[model samples]
Target: MMWKTVLITIFAAGVLADDFSQITAVVTSQCTKNNAEDKVPEVEAALRTFGNCLKGLVDLNVLKTEIEEAKPNGALDEVFKKYCDKSAQLKGCISSVLQGVRPCVGNEYANHINDAQNSTNQLIDFVCYKDGDRIALFIAEGGPECFQQKTENLKTCFLNLKQSFPTVESANNLSLVEKCAKVDEMTSCIVKSLEECSTPTPANMAESLIKFMRKDSPCHTALPVSIV
Candidate 1:
């Protein structure tokens, strides 16, 4: 009788261990990255914390027992069936982790990078106010030669402003801008992906973020400045 109870306890613990292994595997695969260059410190920290929590849930001793109890009669599957809610728990935990981490993520790119901030602001005003069109029209009334010069000046201004930052702060500020831009792009991609995943388990969410980031796409393309 005692032996029977011991065996049952081991098997039940093994089943739970299996579930934890599955959940942690998914979390680790999704959170781990190769290139640090494209990572934001806050996002990376969140990923690390989330991964560690998932890994901590795994029980190695029970996992070993599960390996020993492998039978051809599908006992493991039967045990797994008892924990129908495990998947749901994983999904809920993932949502909770993301919610906790979301507050840490911010538009550091636009906030910290003076050059990017100025460029973005200028672009917004130019597009919204049609400043370029008015300048082009004003210069065109003078002569074709004057209009051409105006167009050149507009292009130069756009390029110069996009590249400009305080000389004292350029080196450090540029690095921060690059990191923040990648983080912004990654956060945007992850948000879009989470919307698509009706049930975002740790694995599913991680997979989505990893898939998008692996593409290594550019953050933004330069807009053409038309003086004509």
Candidate 2:
């Protein structure tokens, strides 16, 4: 029993390290695209702090005593209020500051500031808060032990329809009617692909959902080069 416990602890640590690296890649990629590379260090620092708080919840080391007596949603809400709320507020404040400082930094630098702010807030809302909600739901449904089977059963299904797929009907150009038809086809393809995934959990569901959103979402207009 002692040897088994030690092995489980080592395995869990390895899995956690891999999971954290993947999450870091996703957030850093977004930061680079948004031209906010300088903010990466700060974002990482915040994540580390947040991770410590989360350790308590995940390992049940921090709330072990209280959680047994408390309701699932109630205990989770308490943790969120204590930890996540403060981090969210801090991220929001930093984003606001970046936006506010844009004009003073001159037009040449304004675009960078706007991108930085936009990406930061998006990360906070879409990644941090959304994942937090997922975790809360996981706890409500019986926590990490319950999710082990879910993670094993979950399948990530992706159907990539290139931009040219819709345009190809008109020799790399799409008519209004053709565009609408292609959009319908794309939607159907995605639905069919999802149907094939055997029992998806929240973590698996996000992979394709975010990709689809990014594919269809409008990009910000490129900033004009400033005349000297």
**Residues 1-228, model 1: lDDT tens digits:** 112222222322333342455433433332343222233344444445545554554445764465347334435443333332243443443444444333222333213233322333433333223323322232223323332434544454334433443343563555544644534444444344333433334223334433333233233332111111
Q: Which candidate ranks first by lDDT, i.e. highest?
A: 2
What candidate 2 gets wrong by more than 4 Å, as runs, is: 1-73, 89-120, 126-135, 142-216, 219-228
lDDT of each: 0.37, 0.44
**Number of the predicted model whose TM-score against the real structure is largest:** 2
Clashes of each: 0, 0
In terms of lDDT, model 2 sits at 0.44
